[model samples]
Target: MKVFYYLKHIGLALLPHSWFTRRQRKLEQKFADQQDYIQRRVDYYLKTAQPFTLAPEETTAIADYTRRGFTSYFYDLKEYLHYFPKQCRFAYYFGDETHIEPRHTLFKARPIAGDNERSVIFKLDKRRHFRFVEDTLSFAEKKPMAVFRGAVTQPHRIRFMETLFGHPLVDAGQSNPSETHPEWQQPFMSVEDQLQYKFLFALEGNDVASNLKWAMSSNSLVFTPKMVFETWFMEGTLQAGVHYVEVKDDFSDVEEKINYYLAHPEKAQQIIDNAHAYLAPYQNPDLEDLVCIKVLERYFSLSGQLEK
Candidate 1:
């Protein structure tokens, strides 16, 4: 993503540089046109006539969930996970003592060097024990700055989802909602792909959330499609199963995960099956994309994007 942006910028930068030299700036123009086309497509997606932001039932359910500090975790996750980067010009996340600490503090975290130190800490609310490691000049320069130590265990991961979501993650090998219409059929879009992108986008919005968190096996590593469904769904609701899982905050890692999944034959088959089961609910072709889009609209509204 950053490379795309840089290429787009460098291409334009060449225009000014070329003006002084007067050679054919054809390549620069091509890059500029490409960038513009990409931007236009994104704008179209955003501006398309979306379904209502949320159904009345959905709004009521979400409001009730929030009072308990639990909303539709998947929906919120999807919004914060995906839509942000495509929308915001300068989007980044920061983790610091203030947001990570038990309570808010005046010592806020900033991007650049200051009193802020790179560190990793785990807070177990039940035990009230904060386990952490301090940062040094050496560690900060590496590719991924370490934060939380010890991989989040599977049980703990489930517990975390339950805590934030008010329920367990969806289960695997469960039945999908029965299709209603005779014309309904599975669409081409991949549900797992949509989920990965959405999750990545959400991670991008949080300041404490690292770009490496997904690749490092924190949230991304732990949440496989099978595991995600198993954790979220009920006993029999998820009919088929989960397909591929990819969670990477970094742009390069994102592309790598996509490629890795694509290349793995066995994994790809499972992913396809899982996505089909998930798509069973929206048997109507028109409603398949609507499912994701409507969820996102609800998310943005909850996050105050729809407010006048």
Candidate 2:
């Protein structure tokens, strides 16, 4: 798929230079259409025009970016930069630290709200974080219990995993082995394995829950507390009960929420449907390219780079 994206980008480069510029102009107008879904997302991601500039030495050419992190970040960003010179400058971050706030850099995670202006989001590490599953099991066919399998490295998840790790209604366990809690260690379960259950946990780890995009795409109902971190998925826009069953930060309400949904399959199915609808737009590769291009254009325009 990455090769196909590269070939398509090379194909686009053969078109007249004006074609790319015109495409960007049309998309900028699309971002202005207040009623458009794409516009709403663009607005949320890049709320205000943050005018800034970078010294030549401070900027790293996108091609020259170190590939120590996921090489997938390079592929995702460069796919949209075929029109620009290889030396075009960009700043980026590719790590688990959620506090990353560069003046203008491509980053994976950002706060859902408050003190977020310095961060500019792009779909970095998309293959890992945003990959969706093809869940065929229906909400009714799956078991009533919820399942969770991940490292207990995040502060938010420690208590939940400790308290409910052995609960009868859940199959929760730590996948990453820990010397402190060797008893809770279990083999990793694929997204498909978790799909067998009617409720899937989308607990936040370093930033946003890495399993969230795929979990929401599945047939099972997702159980999560309120989201504090967001990526390209717009976690803040998700309403409790409509997209997923909201649980208390503690596992205080997990069983109650899961039992309610088990009894009301219709309500569970509705949340699954809403989740699929939310994820539908992101499935398109062309739309992804266009949105990324619009974002890059804004970064360049506001930073005084496009003027050159």
Candidate 3:
């Protein structure tokens, strides 16, 4: 899959300008029936006032790579920008952009709810963030214990592992080796291994949880506290006890939530179905392209760059 990702990048980078425009035109026609949804997405992601030009010094010219090393963020972000005008100006702060001030447009994988105006999120870190799995095992076949396996990046996660490390109903742990906290470390588990559990933790780390997308797409039920950050996946829209089972901030109810769902398999299945439905829009690549195009168009227009 990594090889495929790089190859796709190489192909896009080499592809001529006309090909991208035609692809967008093709997508527009192909999904013409879904204009309302496409516009809604574009508006949701971009809600800033129009006709405001950012200073040239504050903006960046469109290009292939923002810096020397090309990561997945560049790949995803450039996919939306390269086809646009070369003179187009924009500001971009890559990586976990927590709070972006006004007129300071930043493109990142995760944007907190309050910063949505200029955050301009796309699926930037595609290699790690966009993972989908096909689970053949039913909820009945999976273990009853809820499971979490990820890097202990946040202090909140450390507290989670400390509180429930020995709990039998939960099999949660920090999967990465940490010299500072060897006790919190456990051998890394693949997403496939996590599918074995009935409940999967979509705990937030530095940004939105990378596992949330793939975990919600799986057969297992997802457990998460309220999400403060969002991406193209629209994490903020996810409902507690509907799309996923909500966990308290203190995480005092992990076992209780897991146990309640275990006793009522039907209710768990409904939430799983709702999660799949919520993810339905993401299944269409054309829709994503259309939304990306509109987002950039609105961005440039609002930046008062249409005259260029």
Candidate 4:
């Protein structure tokens, strides 16, 4: 399995852009029938399910992009929403991001699905369980520096790395087309290995970093920049000092933040504990289902669909 994974990665790296475009087109064509079926299923589920009791002002129309890349999180959300009870009052507007535009609605919790884009799907329960090196380690025992491993996709990431390249407080390196070494040459770090560190850097890539959830799950304090994007978990809902330390997007204050946290170990641990507590409600799969139901209820109430 490892060999096949590497071979595919290498092939993708060597393949031309046109090859991926053609592959994407083929994927859209192949999933067209399944997409149509899912859409119909969604309609049936919403129209026939038990009615929810909501206030008059709660009913509103929600717009979701119907035509999305097969791998998009929005596609998964569409599938999940099907399991919800039929909400006759809730109305759906199906269109792409370009047409619908993401408002401060339930849909904003999901990543924007687009053509040839890499995105993180918000599924806390479906992650790979990693075997830790040991049961526990003290804050002093773990590496004092923050660790970050990901591809250099955006210019902001590149600039951040360049500034902190040789900083003692940071053990940052690239995993995809690795900056420390060649692509697919170095062994990937397991989640357990990352948990061994005192601090974890959750930087944005093509979209939000998938590692952010795992970081929050761990005992280590998470440091991330103010995100322009959000997932179903809503990073915006988390407070900077309470849940995770917020770093400047330009990364000018990363070093300062790290130094302060290291000096005040108690404060850092408090934030880590708070983050875990904040995420506890979302740890269950049932909460996601409830969120979908509530979102629909609100949409229906706001749109005056119940009056119909």
TM-score of 4: 0.60
Residues 1-308 of candidate 1: C-alpha lDDT, one tens digit per residue? 44663464345433543342232233334345444533332232223223223233223232222213322222223222232223311111222333322211112122222222211111111011111112221211222211111222234332323232221222211112223321222233222322232122212111222222222221122122221111111111323225234342222244354445435545544554454444343233333223333333433543345441
- Judging by lDDT, tell me the better candidate of 1 and 4: 4
Q: Output the better candidate (2/4) by lDDT.
A: 2
Q: Count backbone clashes in candidate 2.
A: 0
Measured on C-alpha atoms, candidate 4 has an lDDT of: 0.55
RMSD of each: 21.6, 3.2, 2.1, 13.8
* Candidate 2 lDDT (Cα, 0 to 1): 0.79
lDDT of 2 by residue, 1-116 (tens): 87986686568757776777787667556646533666566666666666787667767875575547567776677666755555668777777656755566667888887878
Lowest-lDDT window of 10 residues in candidate 3? 106-115
| Candidates in descending lDDT order | 3, 2, 4, 1
**Candidate 2: segments with Cα more than 4 A from true spot:** 1-35, 85-87, 100-102
After TM-score superposition, the amount by which residue 130's alpha carbon in candidate 4 deviates from its true location, in angstroms, is 15
TM-score computed on alpha carbons, candidate 1: 0.19
TM-score for each prediction? Answer: 0.19, 0.87, 0.93, 0.60
Off by over 4 Å in 4: 1-75, 83-138, 178-187, 304-308
Q: Per-residue CA lDDT of candidate 3, range 1-308, in tens?
A: 78997798788878889998898889889999999988887776766656666887777788523654547766777777866888888877667766765664655544555545756665677667767788888999999888888888688888788788879998877878877777767777887888999999988887788888899899899998878788778777789888999888889988888889999999999999999898878877778778888888878887777643
For all candidates, what are the clash counts? Answer: 27, 0, 0, 14
